[model samples]
Target: MEIVLKKGTFLVFLCVAILASAQISVKRLNDPAIVAQHKRMTFESWGDWRPYPKYFLGIQTNFAYATVWGMWAPKINRDYKDGDDIRPLKSTGEQNLRFAQLKFQEEEVKKIKAASDTIYKRSVQDLAHWTSATVDADPLWLLYYKRMLKPITEFPDNPQNFMEWRLKDQQTFETLNSTGTLKRLQEELDLIKEKYTWSRTMDMPRGKRFIMFHETLIRWRIFVQELRRYNNRTTLLLDYRSILNSHLPTALPTQWTPTSDKGIVQNVMQQYKHKY
Candidate 1:
């Protein structure tokens, strides 16, 4: 093949080829004082010479190759053990934060249970008063007064607690001096139902405590409801007495949740360490 080239282009190509093939050398600056002086001289006017493309490219290439060969290589993967997979422990600051959150949750549960206990006491007292007063005022009050009194006496709750339980039955109270025997009893039942409905609507905790609290509340309602009907209907007397037997023993069943003083702290540390 025939080729044509300008004289300047041919000369440039020859120089490049010679530079690539030859063992080139740079003569050191002869004056030791000049070299020493240059080391301290600021080159701010020319910006940074160390950041030149060639210098940076060489540095980056060396680093990339070193990283691959020394760290990311297959030999490193083979040498790694299961122990290496485990994470280190958490920092003191992070442990404190997790423990703080756990404490907050615990306090929240405490607050809820406290509030639930208050409502529970109020409801139980209200039913107790209604049962006690109605039994004493029944037309057949004398016949079974002693029989009904036996359960109330043996129950764990104090009669004094029922003193706080006032009349919430507006209909029964307004007609206290006028309503018929069965009519007053029915309205009183409505009052008991009102308290039961309120208890059912409450947002109680979801644990063993919840079951015990709800069951006791329900049994109290059943006992009271049976008492209201027993006077007019003798068949309900046995059911009324039976509910009392089941309720008295479990009158205040409390679930004791075991707690660890260091649990929150330990859990926080584990979570921060990625061990959780």
Candidate 2:
């Protein structure tokens, strides 16, 4: 009698559970809003499950001395909105260029500061070691002492002049590298042409020659490179901001989630998938 009663109760509970599930299915089928909200929520949840890049702005800020001030680009299909027009992924070279430029700027700035410090230090050494007549005769040493001793901001009132100085310096190096310019500069000299070469200019003592060709040109090149780099950075930053502001259509259509259909509608489509 006890066994019979337990079997009956179990049957009743199974019936009630089946009925509850049926009621839920019916309500979902009748209510389109519920289905839509479910799909939207599912898609959003999928984004939460998405993996982050191995390295990003947060990594740079926390681990490196550098920080990105510009808008980080988002992958189109991954970071989607209701009608966002997706843009194609940039070419590998173009994609890498962003980080490369940032690193280049950081290193370039460090090099400039180091060069400035060295100039001041060398000037101090020269003043101590050399006679007053010799020290006074060397105008470049005096200039370095004066310039590096002051803060960079205090020394320059005109930005345009500073840029011009950079351009003038670049022109000097290019001119020196031009054909029929440096008779000693041989084509097969086995020197690394891209980077700065001290082998050629190091032995040339710190006088008018060194000031005109080496010190002046190098400083100017730094200024020009960094100035152009920052200007380019400004353009990229503004463009990215504009992209964020606009709700324009992206390149790709929004990907629908698994539940993005009305009730068993997706099941019907799946049945035809193999045949198609």
Candidate 3:
């Protein structure tokens, strides 16, 4: 009985020792220091660029052969077979311009006039879109609000340092708004009208026709530029108003009007009547 009891005691001790050893091993495996050492060893052996695999030598040999072939192959030009078409190539720009001229002749003044009208209509549409309430609800406005608020919010905590940041924000806002994109668009429209008198007559010399077409192209491009600027200004204005409403609600007037000197903010705020 005593021998049996001794054997049982030995078996229990052995099992406890095995379990304790497994726990220690697991803890060591999970230890940050031990994991870092293993990572260092792995990087030194395989991750580093110096110690490449056995197949890398084969790749190097193949690359050398490819380089030799590329260098020598272009020198061995074969004779062209009969019936192959050979033509002189014009530049891409010249070809495109020639294509445009041909298309212009086919469509003539009607198409160009229609395109000009469409551009004007699109500018009007963009104005309506800009003044809509949807601009305020954009998810990106949250990011803009956070960015604008950071300097102002931090101002009380660190007045001197944050003052510089606040000034920078205000400068950026004013610089962006001062582009006067809408005024530029109106000026461009008047210029287009003045220059477009030639298009109506269409009895000009061949040289004048080309010149007029070039001028028309320039006017169209100017319209595009002005419209882009207008859209940028629209976004900036909306973002500025959002910042103001969040931080300084009373800065804007209660009554917004078309003739009011407040500008785009007055127009946009009209959509939110209750907010004011």
Candidate 4:
């Protein structure tokens, strides 16, 4: 009798479990709203969040002191919003940025602040002026930097040009809308570039140029490259991966992320480009 009773109870538990699972499946399949919510939640739940990129950003903020702000041209143009251009920033990533900016403790900021304090040291200070003077003197990087950050409308074509994607002014006259002229835009880029005149040191090599600053940028570059690959893979899976899906299709990847303390993303991307 005990054996029979045990069997009956087990059977009832199995039925209940199966029924619950079936109900979940049915609800998800039948309801479009449920599917949309599921997608939204899935979009937000990327892994690796607890510590945030606070340490990373702090390093970049300091590094920007010695680094130049410039534009990056790549597989996509910044003007349109289709194809490989604009990747959706997951909602969780947005939240992480907010949290990092807000609740950092006193000690955390103090540490990063110390590194930056080294900017006033006599050796580094002289070097800073010397370096800035040299870059400021260069019209080529200046021109490149100027036109680089400006919209792709200013560029003739993508780095790997396919005549079809070209945005010649005569062809797309209606699409042209400039809030500022090229001269004004160049001034704006130059002014923004001037803001990073000082940087913090992370053990800072005795005479190293841009030290922690350049290294941090390298790390960010790698990070962004990896994120781009992931974005591309995910995009391929979506039904709409074409340019029409974008609210503002861009041919450029404006921002950057780095990969390591030892090297910049430029170095890494070069190493990996064969595979990319």
Ranking by TM-score: 3, 1, 2, 4
CA displacement after TM-score superposition, residue 26 of candidate 1 (Å): 10
lDDT of 4 by residue, 145-254 (tens): 33433332232331222122232332121111121222333343333333222322223332453443344344434533543453343333222223323542432132
Instruction: Give the residue spans of candidate 4 off by over 4 A.
Output: 1-208, 239-276
Candidate with more favorable, higher lDDT: 1 or 3: 3
How much lDDT does each candidate structure score?
A: 0.42, 0.43, 0.48, 0.40
The per-residue C-alpha lDDT of model 3 at residue 41 equals 41
RMSD in angstroms, all models? Answer: 31.7, 49.1, 36.8, 46.4
Can you write out model 1's per-residue Cα lDDT over 1-276, one digit (the tens) per residue? 124457777889999988866633222344443343343242212112121122364454444334433333466523432113221122333445577878999999999999999999987765543443333443443464335334433443321221222223433233222324435445554554454443334433223323433454555557566544433233232233345447644321122111232543454355456533
Better of 2 and 3 by TM-score: 3
Error of 1 at 69 (Å): 36
Q: List TM-scores for all candidates, in order.
A: 0.22, 0.19, 0.25, 0.18
The per-candidate count of clashes, in order, stands at 0, 6, 0, 28
The positional error of residue 95 in candidate 3, measured at the CA in angstroms, is 63
lDDT of 3 at 195: 54
Cα error, residue 233 of model 3, in Å, equals: 1.3
lDDT of 2 at 13: 100
Stronger candidate by lDDT (1 vs 2): 2
- Where does model 3 exceed 4 Å of error? 1-184, 200-202, 254-276
The superposed Cα distance between candidate 3 and the true structure at residue 249, in angstroms, equals 6.3
Q: Indicate which candidate wins on lDDT.
A: 3
